[model samples]
Target: MVRAGLMRIARLRVTLAYGAMLLVVTSALATLDPLARERIVEKASTNLHNLAHGHFGTLLGSAFVVDAGAIAVWLPNLLCLLALAELLWGSTRLVVAFMVGHVGATLLVAAGLIAAVKEGWTSTDITRATDVGVSYGAMAVLGAMTAALPRRWQALWIGWWIGVGAAVVATGGDFTDAGHGLALVLGALVATRFGAPEPWTRWRLGMLAVASWFGFAMVVSTTAALVPATSCGLLCALVGGLASRLSALRTRPTPSATDMVPDFERHALS
Candidate 1:
């Protein structure tokens, strides 16, 4: 019994390992004075300047580091999400999907930021903006999970995320949002290797309209950090609701063809 219990726990070794690492990093951060901690976080950021200087450590370190005060929120949320991804994709696939989203999204966002700076669409100071956390990859994994959702839900979920991310960029919301959108795309793309969910239903045309408009509102309202932190915490809470719905439905038997018809479509026909 003991061995069996331990074996089951070991299945989530990746999530556990990550959570442990975060605690260690947070403890060390807490030891420092406020100013010093802030400075260290700034230095540890994988911002454009740090990347330009080729300080690879910052790139790796940023993913594990979070402000001491924020860990309470960060720890639980990430552990839940990461564990879900690990369970679905296995340890190796989860890690690969995450790192790819993190690194790829960071680079893509940075490139876009550089162009914006050059074009004078934004400030140079934005380049020095603090960029850290597991969200980029987390969002990717979240995006990748679209495959597990119902057919119509798969369309709306992915569409809403992409719309929000794109609106953030188009409206100059934040570099973070740009990265988020890209990570979602990257994750979804990679997940296609595992076989995609059913394609979008014709009803998706209506869902696209609903998702795009509301997704814009979700982005503009929070516009700060649409991930799972700081200003984006509200957005994260909404995503939390979505996740709960996803969990409830993940194991549900496929809906009948008639049952799958969206309410709006049925109402329209009526």
Candidate 2:
């Protein structure tokens, strides 16, 4: 019983950490100058003029745009949702999934932004915010859960992805569908890889960390080619990567069927 309680508490801590970070960042941005806030909203929304002021007014009211409209302040919200999802799916698997999904998504978004800028479809003043939602993380969580669920339910994950894709289309402006698709693929791959416990080698963790950081850096550097944006991405990647690696290190070996029976009986008796 004590062990179970401790495990629950640990899961709650991860969820709260993500949520707290979002709250802090959003709250701080809300205190920024009104003009700065407006500029950030403008950069975040491609259809700002078409969408009612109230539609994104709340988000804009709590966001800040930094470094000439290169990076906007909504990361906390995204991270909070991701963390909550991670907690729900158990720390080990979800953390790995989040890292892969986030980095992969960011890279795709950066690529789209770069292409848009080159084609003169979007200005340097605009930052794309379409693919930064928590829906992808939620989808990944659902995907991982499907492994435990009946096989017939496997198609549900695909349906969820399609729904998200449609949502992106409906909200289209400078949205990047490529980013969403890439994230789903990466999330699924990570989920499949980490589904079973394997040897925890420092080299494997280090390689993943390096790749994750490199991808994060590319996203930051390409977004604005500015110091602040790059700095933010670097910091996020470092902290997030460390947390993920630690969780992976702590992953227990998969139990055999015999090992599971006693635990099931104990729980059933309890």
Give the number of the best model, judged by lDDT.
1
lDDT of every predicted structure (CA atoms)? 0.71, 0.47
Over 4 Å off, model 2: 1-6, 36-89, 116-148, 163-173, 176-178, 196-270
What is the C-alpha RMSD, rounded to one decimal, of candidate 1? 11.2
**In candidate 1, which residue ranges exceed 4 Å CA deviation?**
167-172, 195-270
TM-score of every prediction relative to native: 0.70, 0.46
Q: Write the per-residue lDDT of candidate 1 for residues 81-175, one digit (tens) a residue.
A: 67666666677878878888888898898888889989999888987899887778777777777765665566556655655565466555577
- The residue-level lDDT of candidate 2 at 139 comes to 39
lDDT value, candidate 1, whole model: 0.71
* Model 2, span 23-136: residue lDDT tens: 565566578897875665554542323223334432232222222221243343344344444543566677667556555555465666667777998886544242233433
Clashing pairs in 2: none
lDDT (C-alpha) at residue 54 in model 1 = 85
